[model samples]
Target: MNMVQLERMKNDKGFIAALDQSGGSTPKALGLYGIAKETYTDESEMIQLMHEMRSRIMESPAFTKERILAAILFEKTMDLKVAGKYSADYLWENKGILSILKVDKGLLDLQDGVQLMKPIPKLDELLVRAKDRHIFGTKMRSVIKEANEVGIKAIVDQQFEIGAVISAAGFIPILEPEVDIHTPNKEVAEAILKKELIEHLKNLDPTYQVMLKVTIPDIDNFYEELMNYPNVVRVVALSGGYPREEANEKLKKNHNLIASFSRALTEGLNVNQSDEAFNHMLDQSIQSIYEASI
Candidate 1:
């Protein structure tokens, strides 16, 4: 599929599910789920788990084509075909789930209340591959833990620069500058993030349109200012470290935002559970998260 088809997919489906976990974060997720580190050492083992998870999701009626508009995927899982027939993208698209690629390499060392993603070399090559694979969009992330103007400016500049490149290539870009939920001054940091984001976006070429995945703000309707921007397609919230229930509570306050949560969305699912048990859990998760989105 080309960019035009991808845009159609986005328009036809409104919600997105983020399943992208890079190498650095995968270990943390495994540990959280009590999966032994050795299980992920063999690349095949991890791939198998991802495949099964996707299978279960597609099997569930609750996670129908209309419910999950798209799924954000890690690089390794991008080309994987489910049931040895449909590519991950095709499999989901059959059910109305557009595919989105996670493009950032990973994060760098924490510096003064912020951390930037490591630079990706030959990013054009990756974008080409994403296009060939029929992915509808791409996402990259950086973290802001405090209200430092210098750090925030740098983060905003880099995201818009990358986002511009992505938009030019015909993929909608999800620019995620996640503020840490644990920050002592989360409200302050979010206020600054919104301001910096708006300023940079206003200066961007009118052709570039992007989505935002930010932390659920500390204050209600804090992101209203951002949603008003013409270039922003939508605003989605990350779970940060919050549990599912708490995350849902906060999400309900903001009528404009929806969820792209990872851990919180999968909090109760276990890889080792029986088929019935697994699907039951996934059903609950989909129900809760879907309700919160609306």
Candidate 2:
């Protein structure tokens, strides 16, 4: 493990940037960036355009370690070059930002009112590749749509099970069991999730500290205890479809939780904007998120 990076992650005052929109979410991400589906003829072209957009964001002066502690990357992005260096290398060496890879193979069909992550085949091989690329950690996500105890427990179990493997392989694993913001019983689900997570956290190996990426709890500081757990390095909140403003507001109310936003981070960015306009917009976004984080 990179001890410097680990220390920074444990103590950084900035938010993480979730730039890891995979195959399923890429189209929507592009559309929000002012690129239409009709603009790309094939998967290759779509991926290329998506890369271009990510590169643009990464290269911006505003996207630095000053306000962004790390970036979560798609596999392709980790392999691809940004400013003539591999994305992870560029992020760490040039920008001082750590890189985390999104390792889940997306979620399975809804079951027990939750969507558990699909099996990650050849995970060891991927971890080897990620480590070679200078990636610092891994992130996997599962979703909870209701307050079903059985479902929520299943989700947490899977996350910790996979997280243990990732940790054993020498990378911190960010276990994200996101509670759907639109769930009618969102608060109830959060309560159940908190209980399950605490139990799992208590049983984790003392040497392996993991991070968490979850939805902002329905109650302010509801996750305070989770943050204080010795086995927890940090607890970050996903925007989870909230508008940037609302997400920031909610985040501010939760003292220790920081943001790991996808859409909200790139809310007003457009592909056609001038460099000055683009950087200005990104600067504003970064400042807002950073302030909320601190």
Candidate 3:
């Protein structure tokens, strides 16, 4: 682990840029960025376009360490380059921002009111590659759709189990057990998730610290105590499906939790915009999220 990056992560007054949308979510991401699905005929072409979009964002002056503590990257992005340097290296060496790789394959079928991560075959091999690329951490996401105790416990257990592996590999893990924002019993699900998370966090070894990325809670300061846990490095909120304005408002009500937004961060940015227009829109987005964070 890089000690400098670790300290910044623990104390930075900024949000995380979640630029890690994967194959399953890429088309929608691109479409929102003004590239329709019909424009890309195949998956490879689609991925390349997505990379181009990400590269544009990374190279923009508006996307910098001033308001962004770190960036979460997809596996393909991790392997690619920005400005002729590896993506992670470019983020750290040029922009002074840390990098985290999204390590989960994707979600499994919804079962027990939740969706766990698909099995990551040869996860250690992937970790080895991430480490070689100057990655500071890793993120994996699972979802909670209901308040079922059995289901929520299973989700937290799976997150912590994989988190331990990532920790042992020398990368901090951002364990994300996202509660569905549209779930009918959202608050109940969040309460159950908090309970399950606390129980697992209590049992974690002192040497293994982790970060958390969760949906903005229905109640203000719902995860405040979780943020103070000795084993927790930082607690970040995912934008989920919330639009940028709504997400920023809700994030401000929660005292110390910072943003790790994907869609909300890129809400108005389109590939067709000129450099000046794109940078202006991105600047506005970053500023709003940064203000809400602090």
Candidate 4:
């Protein structure tokens, strides 16, 4: 199948596997890993909203100009059956504008009912599908070698299991720090920030900034904490989940140095600030960070 088709059906399994295999194994590491998973919820509602948003995606010219694309947020199962039902192009020899590209079978148990669209080499084999899918730009970010004309990078919502997202999309992740079963929390997310310390500061090649779309009680505290890590590629605080007035108020003290999203879907302002706008605003913001860091 072609890569375009892969993007349509791709999901975030690889991303999770990488996080699980971070090898830190320390209490702090394990605790941070768990925090990444805190934001995860079942994909039922999110999936439903994705379909609605997809129909409306091409509706807005601004969103289209931004190259805003939609992606599947997988939770274990790559139900080819469902994919076929929604857009059978996934199984066909020909991948389409709306088809599945990459998949994260790393943490999945096919015997447990998970089926991968394009199987990848587990155990660090790196048997990537040349025409299947691209990769996530954050974390498992080794796609620069393989990135081609068709290899448009991608970034899925942050997750405890984000290796798959990075593996398939090649884009940095945008985080919502409150609590989701699949995203990184303050401690864990902040902990990962340490990777920047003693590392490449604006010297990581593509870019050195770190892009994390998150919420914070105090942007100053969050911003200040980042100062300790001079190795950061760059930091973007996307904490629109808080009360708009409050979020704006908090960020105002910080300044516009970081590109923040108002928790909007890029289609409209977010209410209750649910992640329904993920594919467009969050996804796009994360992509910006990936490019900026590179």
| Model 4 per-residue lDDT tens digits across residues 55-139 | 2332322232122222222321122223333322321322222222223333222221111122334513322331223322222
Give candidate 2's whole-model lDDT.
0.94
Local error of candidate 1 at 191, Å?
Answer: 1.0
lDDT of 3 at 202: 85
Clashes of 4: 48
lDDT by residue (tens digit), candidate 2, 154-233: 99999999999999999999999999999878999999999999998888789888999999988999999998889898
Worst 10 contiguous positions by lDDT, candidate 4:
12-21
- Estimate the lDDT of model 1: 0.77
Residues 82-128 of candidate 3: C-alpha lDDT, one tens digit per residue: 99999999999999999999999999999999999999999999999
Per-candidate Cα lDDT values, in order, are 0.77, 0.94, 0.95, 0.30
**Per-model TM-score versus the true fold:** 0.91, 0.99, 0.99, 0.34
Residue pairs in candidate 1 whose N, alpha carbon or C atoms collide under 3 angstroms: none
Alpha-carbon deviation at 44 in model 1, angstroms: 4.2
Q: Please report how far candidate 1 places residue 226 from its true position, in Å.
A: 1.6
**RMSD, model 3, all Cα superposed?**
0.7
Off by over 4 Å in 1: 1-14, 31-34, 85-88
Candidate that beats the other on lDDT, 1 or 3, i.e. the better one:
3
Off by over 4 Å in 2: none
